[model samples]
Target: MEENLRNNLIDKLQNNTISSEEREELFKLYNSYQFSKEWNENTMGNFEDVRKKILKGVKLKRNGASRGKIYAINSFLRIAAACLLVFFTGWLGYTLILKPDPNVIVESGKSRKEVVLPDGSKITMNINSTLTYPRVFEAKRREVKFEGEGFFEIQADRSHPFIVATPHVKVRVLGTAFNLKAYKEDPAIETSLIHGKVEVLTAKEERTLSILTPNHKFVVDKIALITSHLPQTKSQIEVVPMEFIDPSNTAPVDLAWKEGKFAFASSPFQDIAREMKRRYAVDIIFENKEAADFKYTASFEQEDVVDILDALQLVKPFKYRKEGNKIVVY
Candidate 1:
């Protein structure tokens, strides 16, 4: 093909009017350039290089080749493959590389997310939750921190124990399934043991270390002189047996959010509202503080946001309205 004729065909091919003959010619050009890496050079520094290469194929100007005769294609697979390989291997003479590390994931919102750690320990994260962890296991010890709420089921290891650190308290578990609730505003931290045992350590000097047994719960309770003095606000670690038809049900509930369910395992009204904020990406405010303690005992059939809210309103007495994507309290 003459240079002028080839340029006309290449332009037509790029414009979607390519005929069978032109398609074959384009493929030939692509293959020729692919094998001829001597002229390709190294343009792997920026991701945009591959982008442009895909939109515009590499074309050489020979003695008689038309200046406008350039091969182009939308597919940039070859460029992507070459650039990715070079970038990851640092062959482009660059010192730094962009590598993503491992993460700790937590879930909670009108629901919870339960995660098993690298060492076989479990974490039940509560609504719109997140957890950060190292990609590889460290030989010394496994450590994780939580923001909102979660339950952990840790595989027991005598030599390497599991440790969970919140802002003020640290709970080390040998091998156990325990619930940890640490809301930022709330003063108390609750660690509910579902199985096995753990040691709860606090920052305060007055309280000694407490050994939490299965079914016994741990809470850091604080109190001030309020309406009644019987117990102003007792924040201490205590154990209470967890009711179970089959206690393992906690895992499904903890993990339901990842599968897209705004779950509520008998969570309170305000607690559920906090979850609504996270799951629905809305703001929830309470007009009354007394509404905070309203307990709910029903499990919801996993459904859409509107359906869940309607069901909750009927099951519990509360008025709510939707403002844009947000649900506000009157």
Candidate 2:
């Protein structure tokens, strides 16, 4: 596209006068520019150049102004610097604000990430999770694809219902705060609501499985559904109250991981080990089959993996040893 045409299209977008065809043309241009060699080579250098100019301006004006005046001047300079930085950073601002393609965010190893959507909804992703969302939602609905686990604080839009699609289930809500765990290796998919209401639905059929209220959880038994040989019609699901370690404080066990705390209630040893493997970036091997099926409840905050293993042994009397990079339990 020509520079004049690009500027004209951008002006139309800013004034909310761009037709659908023009928007499509702008998106195609952005997509082409994103993959060009110029974008790859010049982005970082342009950012550095803009940063230096902003810093030079700040230092030059600091000595000439009063304290109050300097504060105001610095604030104005910051805003100007941001505008200049965005202008020179190629089409990044435009892509983030106007692109039609979905954006994928992945959190791997032991790290967590916080993502804010275009509509101001917040998502805090757990380790080994992936979320895919568009830069902007459609006029009629807001939707995203998710896997693993995430804590969502959705922005309320009654006209456009927010939907989260996982492999096994879907969660629909108007505006709510909730934690959804749908790890592939886990036995079940758990959706725990903190506040507001949500409708849980079947992924394949889009059938309503359950409606959840605050301090409640909806669970889908994935293992049972997968293993059953007969023609399965209804999914084995359960609705239960959220677990609280202390009734006085009323903190849900589902949200403990967000606080850097691991809390489990009568969870299987193999399932706990899988979570530990992701959280600590270590492999756990079970030499004894009985140990893998052992049920235990435990909670720890900021403890080393070895310390947690040792603590668990004191209660259940299981033996485990570190063998190179893997922890072997017998």
Candidate 3:
């Protein structure tokens, strides 16, 4: 009799004809009874579709329901669905629904995205970047994991330091504005300070690589850090003055990308190609090693990929042929 009543309630719910009393009864029945193996096998094939229909049907039927009743029913149904998923889908549902990570932020394709952290710090993420941080920062320090590139304007908090961890180096700052470039494929990790102070540290925080000031850049060579054998006392970081778009204006080239500008300062041809690939969502193929190693210094705004390539050709002779979304340069 209980099994028949439960099946009847489920059928009513699926058909969008379940009454308020029936919904309440169904909620209680779901808690008490385990679903049959045959029913689970049949429903598993269209789980997502069934889940969507169930929620949509409930929402449509709740037009005249009281707020308190609606809340109770909605909460119960969500839990019931989760229970069903746990039994039917096994670990996939448990990981995605129950033990989900709430703050793994990702930006894909060729557009930049701005994210405001819990402490009111703003991060402008470049194309193809990921940043992970807790929903609420810890009491001692505000820490985040980052890769690709981003422009950070951190909120000032002397008590709680802001830390950014990348593959090669860890950056610690009290409160500072800086641009970090740490693409996994790139040979070096770069931190360009715009204002305030920041300390670049080794992977384990054992050594201070460099302390950056305004208009300065700190670079870490990944190959050198990996291949070195001796106990070196000197810092392995290269500190350089930030590249300017023009000497007269005093505007640093590093911050240009956030403003929709593509700037490079005597950057290798391959690096330029990589930047273009991210900005334009295209692939660049080098036919010759010499072409790939050619150094170029230029800044561009409001130009298409082909136009930029044409401009580069004027500076140095190179032949390139377009093949769909890719450009092959020789």
Best TM-score among the predictions, by candidate number: 3
TM-score of each: 0.52, 0.65, 0.67
lDDT of 3 by residue, 23-134 (tens): 7666555444364333453633354554465555456556556676889899999999999987888777778889767666666446888999999999999888888888
Residue 117 in candidate 1, Cα distance off native in Å: 4.6
Q: Is candidate 1 or candidate 3 better by lDDT?
A: 3
Count of backbone clashes, every candidate in sequence: 22, 0, 0
lDDT of 1 at 191: 74
**Candidate 2 residue lDDT tens string, 1-330:** 565675575556555576666766655554564423333223223434433443444444455457769899899999999998879675886677675556655554467889999899999988888888887786688989999999999999999999999988889999999999999778789999999999988786336778998988888787654533344624466788888766674777888888888888777789889989878888999998899988877789989999889988887878988988899999
Clashing pairs in 2: none
Task: At residue 126, give the lDDT of candidate 2.
Answer: 88
Q: Write the per-residue lDDT of candidate 1 for residues 195-226, one digit (tens) a residue.
A: 78888765332333578876666656533212
| Model 3 CA lDDT for position 254 | 88
